[model samples]
Target chain A: MNIIEVNHLHKKYKAITAVEDVSLVVGQKEIFGFLGPNGAGKSTTIKMLATLVSPTAGTALIGGFDIVKQPNQVRQTIGLVFQETTLDERLTASENLFFHGMLYNVGRQTLSRRMGEVLEMVDLGDRKNDLVKTFSGGMKRRLEIARGLLHYPGVLFLDEPTVGLDPQTRNRIWTFIHQLRQRENITIFMTTHYMDEAEHCDRIAIIDHGRIVTLDTPENLKKMVGGDIITLSVTDRERVKSHIIEKFGLPVKESGQHLQVEVPGGETFIPTLAVDLGERLRSISMHRPTLDDVFLKLTGKAIREESAGAWSGMRVHMRGRR
Target chain B: MRALKAIYTIWLRDVIRFYREKTRIVGMLGQPLLYLLIVGTGLSASFRMSFAPQGFSYLEFMYPGIIGMTVLFTSVFSAISIVWDREFGFLKEVLVAPVPRWSVAIGKALGGSTIAMLQASILLLLAPVIGIKLGPLMILKMVGMLFLIAFSLTSLGITIASRMETMEGFQMIMNFLIMPLFFLSGAMFPMNSVPPWMATLMKLDPLTYGVDALRNIVFAGSPAREFLIQFSMGTDLAVVAAMSVVFITAGTLAFNKIE
Candidate 1:
């Protein structure tokens, strides 16, 4: 069953149309990703679905409650982790969850127990007494995820959950997120500009220009890129190209100094192709198609560095951490 | 019961934060001391007790007003922290919760008032040093006045702050708005014999009655001396309570419109 259903969701802020004609359904316990560049309406669409902002047109429902008409019921059934850090710096990790419990009407008797359980879920059980101000960027994100789960929400909405974290930290957070899906049986709907991050999703909706260009499983979307790219640099390029097409029945093209072909299972095809080419092949390499390629194929432009690159974000964060 | 819990939880968050903010504690304790020492001592030598009731010293008069001033700044600052919370995105956490918006406003006011009252309680300890002997009855009366004034002013603060989008606007209000409210509140000067225009403004200031009410209770302990009471005790509290409802309602309405 779909945990969230959005129908023709539209949002217009003054002159700009932030979200234009978006519709989709997210299955229960599915790790759904909204993949887009910044200003592509990713955050705006999520905010509307999360009931933080009312849509200008159309409607959405989460956990059988209408987002526009029954926002209070929707709020009770879903947890939200905003793009920016939202935890109170003055409060300890446990205190933040304690306050959340009361606001969500979690029983006083069960609040402490749930608090411990959620903190443990995020691997933050030891830092419960520490103020959130002292936590690192990654740890704070983890604490927020833990707090979001304390109410036993049926669904969790995360907006750029690991935007500023390092790569290793991002991977760890993804690990926890996968575990959360498996253990809690809760649907996870998150938005990301990082094409690599979308690869982890059960299905990705590639969005651009305030609309969903395409939605499919990551592997299926990449299949549109004609599978993994195999590049073979040979001393006798024409001879190898002819041999590849004759024996392997695969067409090969020349680019600069290398002969390249698109193939399925590039890793498995490499050894066989190397034996088939033998002495003529000097160097061989494979480039797997990523969600970026799918985005490029759909939008005709790469996700720009201004919004999607993680390394640029990493440099700003590394100033103090390292 | 759940709504009440939500309000209490929000209030508790503020109290816990106030406890940890050492700079705020210092400011709270130091502001009243500075006002009492500088204003009271600076005016004591030049002033005559002829216009004053019961031959009361100038320091004795400014004592209650100084505590009211402390409550004023602390309470307003507490409410203005919402602007900071919005900037930091912490306000969204509260806004998106299943709890109603009115509870959040009430919680903020209660929290600010509690912190303001706590800071004012420290000033109560200095009463004996200033030559005013306080009975337990007088302490109870003063505490009530502190809470009422604090809650009312905090509600006023929330009403003004809910629409403010930036912290830059915060300092401007503290200077251009709060300063005038304090100066005209009859805290520093005699309200009975002020200029016609000044008296009009003083009557309009809520802290005018708050300071006057505190003075009455502070001196009520010492029956031998008569203190200046601007309005009847019941009338002062009634004004505070009535205005609190107005401000809280306005604040909640403003909060409802926040994104």
Candidate 2:
């Protein structure tokens, strides 16, 4: 059964269209990922689903309740962990959870029991008394997750949950998320620009320029490329380009100074190409198709290009403050 | 019942944070005490030798006004936390909660009013030092009036702060509004003696009734009672109570439209 169904949801901010004609569904107890670059309407779509941002046109349903007409029911059935940290810095971890539970009107007896269970799940039981301001970035994120789950929501929306964490911390957060999905049997909808993180989702929707480019399982999405990618840095680009086309009747795409080839088995083809090219080949590498490759093939631009712009924008904002 | 619980929890969070910050308590109290003791004593000596009215000393006259000042500052500044919460992202969490949005506004108003009342109560303990008489019934009336004053002023602050996006902008607007409200409230001078235009402004100021109500209760049986009769205790209480209701309704509506 689908827990979330969005139909042509659109959001316009002043003259800019943040989200336009976006539609998708999240199945019950499934991990659905919204994959996109910065300003690709991923966050806007999530906000509309969470009922935090009212759509300019169309609508959505959360747990069978219309997001606009039945906002309170939708809110009760879903939890949101925003992209930025929202926990009160002055409050202790448990105090923060208590405040959330109280806002949701959780019974006192059940609230305490659920608080303990969530804290344990996030491995934050021992640090429950520490002020959130004193916590590391990962700890604060974990506390926010625990707070989101305190009321036992049917669906949880996590927006870029591990954006600024170290690799080790990101892995730990993913571990907690997996455990949450397994133990609670709750539907999870998350948005992330990180390709590796998107791999963990049961299914992913690739959004670009306010449109869904593709939606499928990770394995199937990779299959759209049809084979492994072989990148070669050759001393003579024109000669290698012609040599591969004439010898194997295969197409070669030039990227900067490198030539790329798509083949059924790149590992087996590399040896014959290396022998045929002789000393003209500078270097060769082969790898399986990744979500980044999928995004690049679909949009003709690397996802990292947008990510770089986002990082610089954040840096400029921080510098302006200083 | 659930709405009440949500309001109570929000209020409790403010109170706990207030106590946790020791510097804030000292700063809020120290400035008012300095104003009461230094300004009160300095002006009283001049009035005594020059134009001291019958049965009224400047220190006794300034006591209620000082209480009003204390409550006004505390109540207005408490609403700055809303802007702070917005800047830090905590306000988003509160806005998305399952409770009604007005409950958050009501909770903040109550929290600010309770703290302001506590601060004014501490100032009340110093009444004997200024040679003012305070009967048991007068004390009860003073407490009730201060609560009304605080609630109204805090609600007004929230109404303004709800639309403010930055802490600096909120403070700028607050300073521009608060100074005029306090000055025109007849907190520092007698409304009867002011010029016609000034008296009109004083009458229009909602805080004027708050300060007048406090004065009527604090100087109930003093010789100045006859002069204070024009600003009757009943009228003062009624006006301040009405103003609190208006401010709270407006504040709730403003808070409901917040992003």
Candidate 3:
């Protein structure tokens, strides 16, 4: 059954339409990725699902509870890890978790047990008594995840969970997240701009301009191109292209020094084409298209620098620990 | 049961953290001392309120007002930490907790009032050093006054904090609301001898009721005091209790609506 059903979600900020007519359904126990570029309504949509902000026009059901009409139930059912750090620095790691458990109305005995369980899960068990302010960024992020999980929430909303971590720490967090999904049978809904991160998700909804452009599996998304890609770096010119086109009886598309031809079995036929074109080909490579290529194809622009900036910032945050 | 646990857990953590910070402890202890030393001493020499019913020294007459001032300042400023917490996002963590939202506001008020009460008691301990003497009955009355003042002011502070969206706006309201309440309540000057309209205004002021009621209890044995010590004693407490109910209700209501 679908655990989260979002229908035509709309959010506006004064003059700008942050999210417009966005809709999606996340099924039970599935790791769903809400992918988008910067300012493409990723955070705004997540905030609506998390009930941090109300939608201008939309309805979302989490675990069969409405997000707007029954917010308290919605809050109880879903755990949220905001994009920015939201833990109390003055409290110890254990204290923070214990307090979170209490706010969820967990009994004292259960709270203590869960606090210990989550601390170990986050690999911060030894630092339980230490103040959270003294913890490294990665450790703090882990603690935040632990705090959110203390209640064994049915669904977890991770908003840019690895936005500011090094690859090692990000991978570590992903490992723990995957373990939790298997161990607890929890549903995960996460938002990120990284293409590789999207690849890890079971299904990704590629969003741009405040709406979902496409929703499909990564392999299927690339398969949408319908043929293997042949990349050629040619030194010659119009004569060689016409000769190849005339001999092969196919059309050639030229982009500067490179020519792209769409034909069946391009990977198997590349050798024959290369032998026929001889010295005209300075270099040639054959490979399948990736998500970046898909993004480029759809948007007529490359993936943004904002995604790289987010990755490097997270990297610096990780290196600071060492 | 779970809600109580949460409140106590947060309360205990704050208490431990408060003690660990020696600067905060000293600052808490120091403010009451300064009031007793500077204000208590400066006004002691040749100071005689002809309106005072008894021949008690000004120090004897002003001790309870100083206690009121200490409680007033400490109790109201206790939520000042909350503004800091809100800015730092700690307040959000507490609000999102499963415990009822009123617990957050009440726990903070209680924590702040505890310090305010302690500060008031410490100010009382300095009375002998400053040469103010009171009987056992009067000492009991002083304790009663401290409780009323702390409970009332702390609740007021929490109400103000809930309405404040930013720390700057909160601080500004503190200056505009608290400072005037302190001055208009007649903590520093003689209210009865002022012009009639001003005296009526002072009488209408709640803090004025607090100060007058506290002074009457502290110096009830003196015959020369113009403030109706007996009349204010009962009414002061009733006013404080009524105001506490009003402010706490308003604070809790607003806190529930806070995102």
Candidate 4:
């Protein structure tokens, strides 16, 4: 069954259309990943589905309940884990879960039962009484997941689950997400900037500038890009464009000092092409085309660009405050 | 049953959080202590005069006022932490919960009120050292006064907090609205001693009613202070209660409206 059906939803923040006529259907027991650059309406879309933000236009249905008209019902069915940690730092992990469970109208007996189960699931059972303030970042994050699952929600919405964590912690979170799916058979809808995380999802939608550029399975998306990603740094773009067109007749997408050649079986062609075009190439590198490569091909810029801009702007803002 | 449980659960979480933040707890007591020690003592003899209402000592008159001030500050800033929660996403957890939106706002007010009441009680405990004496009945009346004061002020604070889009904006409003409310309500000076225009503004101020009401209950049957205190408390409660409903309604309306 399609557990979540969002249809042509539009959310405008005054002059800015944060999400414009976007739509997607998430099936039962599947990990649906929302991939986008920063400020691309990924979080906005998830907020609408989670019923945290009302859409300016259109509708979304979660578990057959209309988000606009039946918000309470929509809220009941969806559990949201936001981009930032939201647990009460002063409260113990169990107390946090207890309150969260009660807010969803879970009975005392049931809340207690589930609380223990979730704490064990997150591996915070031993430290349930310890204050969340003392917990590490990854531990806090794990507790957040436990809080979300306390009510046994059918569709869990995780927004940028691993944005600022180290690689090892990020890997650990991925394992937990997988474990959650295996144990509960719950549907997961997650928004993330990490292109590599998209591989774990059953399907992904590459969203940018308030619109979905494309949607497909990870393997299918790579297949659409059609070969190893061949990136080159060219000294002279005009010479290189003509040289590549005349000599190799291979199609190349030029993007500011970088030429991406997406030939069928690009890895096999790279060595021969490199021999012919020696020294003309400032650099030569080959790798399997990833979601980032697909995003670059479709959007004409890397996904990392917006992320870098967001990070620097955030850093500057924080420093300015200090 | 479930709804009540949800409300209690939400309320309990706030209580737990406030209890855990030791600095915040100490800060709550610190303000009232400073008012009692410095403001209440440093100027106690200097400000004392027969012209003062009922010929009461400055400390005696100021005790209830300090109690009112404690209620005022704590009650209004109750939702400050919520703005932080909203920004951090803790609020989303609550917002998406199955409970009603009014409960959320009320739970916050109740939490803030509890803190205010606690602060007021602590101020009352320091009453003896500050040279104010109260009978057991008067102590009960003081508790009632604090509860009402805290409840009303918390509603006002939560309302303001709900309307605020940013934590900075909320803190600004707190400094702007709360401090003025305390100063203008005759907490720092006798109402009769203030300028005519300032007196007129105080008469209109809701905190003025709170101060007057609290002062009357704490010092019952003082002929000079009786009429104004009862009149202010009675009217203040009604007005504040009505205002709280409007603020809470507006808050829930905004919560439902915002995207």
* Leading candidate by TM-score: 2
* Residues A1-322, model 3: lDDT tens digits: 8899999999998999999998889888899998878778888888787777899998999999998887767878878886667787877898788767767887778889888888999899999999989988789889998888888888988888987688999999999988988887689899888888888888888888788888888888888766666767887767877887898887666644577665668778898988888887898877677786566556644465556655657555433411
Model 2 lDDT, full chain set: 0.87
lDDT of 4 at A271: 84
Candidate 2: C-alpha RMSD after superposition? 2.7
Looking at model 1 chain A, report the run of 10 residues with the lowest lDDT sum. A313-322
Candidates in descending lDDT order: 2, 1, 4, 3
Docking class of 2: medium
- Model 1, A142-172: lDDT tens digits are 9999989989998899999988789999999
Name the candidate that leads on lDDT: 2
Q: In model 2, what lDDT does residue A320 have?
A: 41
User: For every model shown, what is its TM-score relative to the native structure?
Assistant: 0.88, 0.93, 0.83, 0.91
Name the candidate that leads on DockQ: 4
Two-way DockQ contest, 2 vs 3, winner: 2
Give the runs in model 2 whose Cα sits over 4 Å from its true position. A232-259, A268-284, A315-322, B48-51, B228-230
| Higher-ranked by DockQ: 1 or 2 | 2
lDDT of 4 by residue, A1-322 (tens): 7998989999999999999889899899999999988889998898888877789999989999998889888887878887778887778888889888778888789989999999999899999999888999899888988888888889998998887788999999899999999999699999998898989999999999999999999999988888777888877878887788888777878765788787778768888987877887778887888888889878988888778778868545533421
Q: Give interface RMSD for all predictions.
A: 4.2, 2.7, 5.0, 3.4
Model 4 DockQ (Cα-based): 0.52
Clashing pairs in 1: none
* lDDT of candidate 1 over B92-194, digit per residue (tens): 8999999889899999999999999989988999988788989888899889889989998899899888988877687789888899989998788778778
Interface DockQ of each model: 0.43, 0.50, 0.26, 0.52
